[model samples]
Target: MVNLTRIYTRTGDAGSTRLSDMSVARKTDLRVEAYGHVDEANAVLGMAITSGGLREDVVAVLRAVSNELFDVGADLSNPLVAEPKWEPLRIPPESIDRLEAWCDEFSESLPDLVSFILPGGTPGAAYLHLARTVVRRAERAGWAAAEAYGLEVSAGDEPGGVNPLALTYLNRLSDLLFILGRVANEGVGDVLWVPGKDREPVGERARRQREKIEKAQDDLGRSS
Candidate 1:
């Protein structure tokens, strides 16, 4: 089990951090960037979970995913060589398979998409869309890190490479989030985008922008 008795290590005061293996690296390393994006997606998902109006099923899946994302972070933090410690967590094929299964199960109930989906639906769906985009960015970061390292050639043969399934899991997670957006909308489905709807007069655009600005100010006022 992990212990956090000392919260202020101050080890990172020099803009460098230590990994699980006690090796030091810069804060801006690719591995750090990859895990940082995963943490961002996890935070967004957590916000989605705490908010009301989410379907019970959506909450259940996200709850499980929230846990697995930690595994993703752990896998990224610990680099693998020819042999890894028995206790270190590694994202396996089964984890990715579970995500694929969930996507398959949820997708069956959703209607086929005829138009592009805007990030507007229920409160849960909007947060899910935000999470999906963030996960895509995480996937890209993982790919860049993999390039800096190398892709898996054989089991534990690729030195210092991340678990390949971690990348696959993030890819499937974004797909599942898109499907969940449709599920959150229920019978209403996603808000379809009409291509030419925004080609109105400049005055109309200004009016919408003004409303957006007012809404932002009103939100700040409420918090204050």
Candidate 2:
């Protein structure tokens, strides 16, 4: 039961903040950065949810992800200890499995990907793509934190490490967001990538001129 009597605590005004374990750490700490990115990704997910035009099923999935993101943040914020005074909220492996299942469910109808996709489509889908990228960043930050702290389960009265499953959850969430984006773009179709389509040769003359220059340079190098 968490209650926020006041929104502003002014304690972090000095560039320091407390972790879930009540230990003080700099605002730029890797652990702080991991959860901070998770918060950022969650905010983008909120934007996607409110952008409208999403189907009820998609909205339901986004809502669930938003709530689960809080759990991820809690897991990241609370430092692991060998023997904590109480059990802490940790990201469970089953969450990743759920994300995988969602990905499969949503992707089943999407057309085969011949080329890479550009992010734009429906408003909700664009936002989902943005959220997906942010989630990738969160995953990277979480891994960095894990590298810094190590992944040893705390046993006694000792400092514990970040949950590896939490990092995996971020990774799987990103994939699900991508599939959801495609689902949101149903009927409109995905904005497929056309490699060099925008940068095609100006003309045959221009292409020939460039090739001539390259050949001349190669020949000159060989002669020299």
Candidate 3:
């Protein structure tokens, strides 16, 4: 329902921009930083969607998430107020539930994790990994904003705080992206972690480390 006739607005040339409510704030404002990270996360997801070789269902999920992230940005950009002239686009709790459901569904088929995963697999999955990290960063920024501006609305027309639901959405979204990244590696499998594998220790040190790792893995297998 909104239209932008011009992309270039001289208003921000002073290093300040207007929020969704048309209130001016500095470019370095915590709220602005939070929503800016959300925008970055969305763009990375776009890369994942178009990277090719992704499962159709996963693609559909990412597409939906991309749209939701925009709303998340809107929710962050428009600070919470006691009463607004118009209803703001806020992230809903149901959206977080949907992300949880997606995480569970996608995780169902992935192999049980015996070790940590590295962020590399198929090209599509690599992009998903990248997106996941970006989402995590966005979530952190949201928390920082929440810390700076409390999560509760205050009296009057002044913006009070950020939306807690929007923060939760970002948290859940990062998890979903991780699960989908694993799903994207359906054929290639996950790039698993090996503790100190890169160090390549030799002789007695290497022997001790290998023995301990083997014993731990054996214990894990028996317990599972």
Against the true structure, what is every candidate's RMSD? Answer: 7.8, 10.0, 4.1
For residues 1-224, could you state the per-residue lDDT of candidate 1 as single tens digits? 78889989888999999766566878998888998999999999998888767889889999999999999988887776655555567788998898889999988866555457789657888899999999999999988988887765335544487767888989999999998877777734566664453334257775675555445434433432
Those runs of model 1 whose alpha carbons end farther than 4 Å from true positions after fitting are 152-159, 197-224
Assess candidate 3 and give its TM-score to the true structure.
Answer: 0.89
* Cα lDDT, model 1, residue 92: 89
* Best prediction by TM-score: 3
| Global Cα lDDT for candidate 1 | 0.79
Model 2 scores what on Cα lDDT?
Answer: 0.84
What's model 2's TM-score?
A: 0.86
Q: What is the Å distance of residue 212 in model 3 from its true position?
A: 12
Q: In model 1, what lDDT does residue 172 have?
A: 92
Candidate 3 segments whose C-alpha is farther than 4 A from its true place: 197-224
Instruction: Give each model's clash number.
Output: 0, 2, 0
Q: Which pairs clash in model 3?
A: none
Candidate 1 colliding pairs: none
